[model samples]
Target chain A: MKLQINNINKSFAGSNNGQSAVEALKNVNLTVAEGEFVCLVGPSGCGKSTLLNIIAGLTAASSGQIDCSGRLGFMFQEPTLFPWLKVKDNIGFGLKILKRSKEKINEVVDYFLELTHLSNFKEAYPHELSGGMKQRVALARTLALKPDILLMDEPFAALDAQTREMLYKELQEIWQFSKKTVIFVTHNVREAVVLGDRVLVFTARPGQIKKEFKINLPRPRDINDIEVTKISNAINQELKTEVAEAVKELEHYEK
Target chain B: MKNKLIRLAKPLTFIACLILLWQILYWLKIWPKWLFPSPADVWLTLVKGFANHTFIWGILISLKRIFIGFGVSIIIGTLLGFLIAKIKLLRETVDPIILGLQTLPSICWLPLALLWFGLNEKAIIFVVLMGTVLSLTISVKGAVLNIPPILINAGKMLGADGLNLYRYILIPAILPSYLTGLKHGWSFAWRSLMSGEMLFISVGLGQLLMFGRELNDMAQVMAVMLVIIVIGVIFDQLIFGKIEKNLRAKWGL
Candidate 1:
């Protein structure tokens, strides 16, 4: 299946107190095929989350067309687990809502718990888990739906650095095994290069995709690899310039 | 064991000093033995009331009123809160009204309740309702609002919408706060019911207080006061405290 987002534009009405419509996304375009992992990197307030929200159908784009064939699963910045539910129940939440059979729901939940390595924590609540484990549970909850496309918006941004690195590696392993299409949004250049099959760099406010780099690095690529370093450095340089220009434009408008 | 004793040291010392002071005043002839009763005198009064079988009946009536009124508040409060949190227009209109109600003392509703329902169980139920409903509603609204926006998005992405969205996601996410609200509301309801009994003076711990007042019997007043304090503390420590502790431990929040 192919997911195509064409000429997507999103604007917030009266966001600047009637100065003008605040354009969050500007003519954004992207395409993903089955089993592809795409990472979107951008500066703060650069509409990376807006794009993800648009793709997930959480928010409507001012003008755009999104073509997708199957269900979309979302993983947010926070774990977003229901505090009142046990881990297994949270994972099987979507299935339960879809009215799947009790036995089938249990089976799928068990499979996802194993997939996310949260089988032992099946009865634990979200508050009982550490940050990384919570995110993993969130991942399991999404995977339980067997969504066609997984949209993640900085899902590990709140974890400690060591935990974040470990999760990134685990995510790569999960992706390799499942071969699911994923669109992950982040501002971390290294994270993008480490996990993405292709990295799309976004500019600051009124965000638009400035460049796309196909990561030719082999599987099990390390963040410290020479190729990874080259891409990260280049992206870092581009981001600095883009942010500087975006700030100048913003200041000019404010005056 | 040593650390546990240390934790009890402060309150234990305070109680010991209070008892010592009371004993001194009693021995010093502060008032006639019949008028200003010693601690032992009040203890005897408590046993006397118990032997007469009036205190237990008063306690039962008070408990019944509290349970009924508190039960109503929990139902109405939770539903009202859910509605206010989910519907923007309702929130805009009803939230301030709830806040206004919360500010007024539970006793302030007594006259109005009597006017509407007269001097009966309805008045007591109305008092309990006034005391607890706002407490539950506020907590529910606050809990619902505090739910991270991402959870809602995740729910919708997982095919939750309309009523299913609320039942599966919003309700569970807000439960801790809702439960916390109930704990708070129960205490308020219990207090209000006792106060209502005091005003009605029919059959309750509150009426026992009125009975002591009518006869100029300070020992009886002291006994009734002790019963009220003991029941309140025991109920909170036994029931609400246990529930709150279990929830926090199991949920790790």
Candidate 2:
């Protein structure tokens, strides 16, 4: 299955009492093929999450079309796991809603439980887990749906630096094994380069895809590797320029 | 050992002093036995009441009314609360009616209930149910309203929507609050049952108090009142208290 997003545009009309019209995205277009891992990287307020929401069909795009022929699963920044559900139950929640056979649901849930290395904590509640562990359960929950397309919005942003790196590596391994189409949103340039086959960078508010860089680096790329750092730096430079231009445009709009 | 005993010291001391004063007042004959029965007289009244099979029947009938009323209240309250939340028109239409019902005292319904049910067990149960259902519904509705939109979205993304949404997501999410509502509802139901017993003249703790009043047996009246207080405290401590403690501990509420 392929995801085709064309000429997507969206804006937020601020409400009364200190509300300003916030143009989040404008004329953004992207695509993801089956088994493709694409990362979106940009500075704050670049509508990275907004774009992901649009893809997941959680937010309606103002003007554009998204044609995807397969199911889509979303992993949010926060784990957003239901506090009332235990870890295994949370992962199996979608199946329970779908009224899937108990046996099949258990099979899929157990597989992911092992895959995410969270089998031991299956009975634990969301509150009992660390930030990283909770996010792992979140990912497992998404994966249990077996969506052809996965849209993740900074799913590991809240974790510590070490945990984030570890999750990134784990995410890459999962992608390699599952070969599912994934669109990951992040602010970390190095993370984008390390995880994504293609990195798309957007300008700040009223976001437009400013540049797309294809990283053909070998698998198991290291952060300290010379080529990886070089690519990261290049992307960072372009991102800085786009951010500066966006800020200038924002200042003009304010006046 | 000392610290543990210290924990019990205040209540023990207060009860001992109260009993001492009661004994002193009785020995001095401050009032007649019928009007101001001593603590020992009340104790004997309770013992004699227990010896009589009528007391047992009264207690059973009263508790039966409470359980019936409480069960109906919980069922209707939970169902209506979910309905009001899911349907806008129902919410608007029923909100004021529930508020009116909640504000009206349980005794105020006695005449109407008696007219409708004809001085039977149903009348007493109706009175108790009226007091409980309103608060339970409001509590459930409030809890439903407090569920964050993000959590609902999370549920939806997991293919949970429609009735499944409420069963899997809304119900569990609102459980703690619903339990709180049930606790409040139980207290209201207990009070309403007591009031109803007084009016309906059933064989219950309330009727026992009334019977003591008719016989001019103040000691028996005080004894029945003590029994009521003890039952209330015991239920609150054993059931609702445990439930609240467990829920708060789990959710860190």
Instruction: Score candidate 1 by DockQ.
Output: 0.65
Model 1: residues >4 Å from true position, as ranges? A99-106, A249-255, B1-17
- Compute the TM-score of each model's chain A versus the native chain A and list the values: 0.95, 0.93
* CAPRI grade, predicted model 2: medium
Q: Of the true interface contacts, what fraction does each candidate have?
A: 0.94, 0.57
Model 2 C-alpha lDDT per residue in residues A1-255, reported as the tens digit of each score: 788889999999887867687889999888788899999998778888988888877889888999898988999889999987789899999998888999999999999999999999988888899999999999999999999999888888899988888887888899998899999999988888988999998987878898999999998777667998999999999998877877787788587
Error of 1 at A255 (Å): 6.7
Best by DockQ: 1
On residues A111-187, what C-alpha lDDT tens digit does candidate 1 reach at each position? 98887788999988888799999999999899988888889999989999998888888899989988899999998
Off by over 4 Å in 2: A13-22, A98-104, A224-228, A241-255, B1-36, B89-93, B111-118
Clashes by residue pair, model 1 = none
Cα lDDT, all candidates: 0.88, 0.87
lDDT of 1 by residue, B68-109 (tens): 899888889889987898789988898999999899999889
Residue A76 deviation, candidate 1, in Å?
Answer: 1.7
Q: In Å, what is the interface RMSD of model 2? A: 1.3
Q: Model 1 Cα displacement at B54 (Å)?
A: 0.4
Q: What digit string (tens of lDDT, one per residue) describes model 2 on residues B134-233?
A: 8999998888988987788888888887888888889989988888888888889999999888767677888888988898889988988988888787
